[model samples]
Target: MGKIVWSVNFTLDGVVQDPTGEEGFRHGGWFGQFGGKDLDEWAKALFAEALGTEALLLGRRSYEYFVARGWASRSGEWADRLNSLPKYIVSSTLEEPKWSNSTVLKGEAVREVSKLKQERDGDMVVYGSYQLGRMLMEHDLVDELRLMVFPVVLGTGERFFGETGDKKPMRLINARTVGDSLVLLAYELVRDA
Candidate 1:
């Protein structure tokens, strides 16, 4: 069975919207606002995670965002891996996926993703799909979380997590500082028996 790992970059204040500023969020581009050795380290960490990922699980909006940003045409080890990996997009309205090796999951998000976890092996990483992530967490389908928390706190924006209606316990598997500004945290969801 595969684990659904939700990997994302968010600010100190839990804002996960438009880190790249491409979405035109009022306080966008907080991701690239910092520079230096820390930024490079963060990039390396992301690349390492991408290398280990078995497949990509994305929401429709994130799929569009990546496609619009030209992730498909980009070249490099990381870009190549991302482009070639099997992309499972959770979208009811998307008729056909434009990116290569992409498939649209048209059923209910939770059920579709739960089936996906059983069919695949290794980690199916979800990136920047806040709504999908929330849904998965609420349904207790997310197995792990890899969060790279940036130092800045964008006072207002869409947060990564929402109310799940109950407390979800997590065990911190790893914690480290990436460069000088970013903190990388890995947590395994503690499921009830």
Candidate 2:
């Protein structure tokens, strides 16, 4: 069965909004503040993670964001892998996805994702889809979380975790430093019997 892994870049304060500063969030561009060898290591870590994942699961907003940023047309190992990977986009209104190997899941999000987990055999990573991530967490559909935490703390903005009603316990499976400043933390959800 497939594991739904919600993986993304986060700040010390849990903010995941507009790391590139493209969006007009008040604390936008927190990701670009760091540089030097550490930033190179961070990029390498991100590339490794992308290469390791079997597929991509994204919400409509994130799908649009990536497409708008020209990831669909970019030519490189990372961009090519991303464009070639099977993508499951969870969107009610998106009738046709323009990205290659894209599939739209228009049914109820929880049910659709649950069926997806049963049908696939590898990890489907969700990146930059906070709303979808929260929904998956609430429904107990998320299998793991892989967070690349940056050094700075954004006091305000969209966060990775929201109100999920109940506590979702997790077991730390891996923890390491991506660079001098960036930390990679992987946690598996502890499911009840």
State which candidate has the highest lDDT: 1
TM-scores for all candidates?
Answer: 0.96, 0.95
What TM-score, to 2 decimals, does candidate 2 have?
0.95
The sequence of per-residue lDDT tens digits that candidate 1 reaches over residues 1-193 is 9999999899999999888888789999998898899889988998999999999999999999999989989999989999999999999999988899999999988888989999999999999899999999999999999999999988999998888889999999999999987899999999883
For 60-97, candidate 2 gives per-residue lDDT tens digits of 99999989989999999989989989999999999989
Report lDDT (Cα) of residue 159, candidate 2.
84
lDDT, candidate 1, residue 168? Answer: 92
Say what the RMSD of model 2 is. Answer: 1.3
C-alpha lDDT (0 to 100) for residue 18 of candidate 2: 89
Position 185, candidate 1: lDDT = 97
Candidate 2 — which residues are off by over 4 angstroms?
none
* Deviation of model 2 at 12, angstroms: 0.5
Evaluate residue 40 in candidate 1 and report its C-alpha lDDT on the 0 to 100 scale: 92
Model 1 sits at a Cα RMSD from the real structure of 1.2
Clashing pairs in 1: none
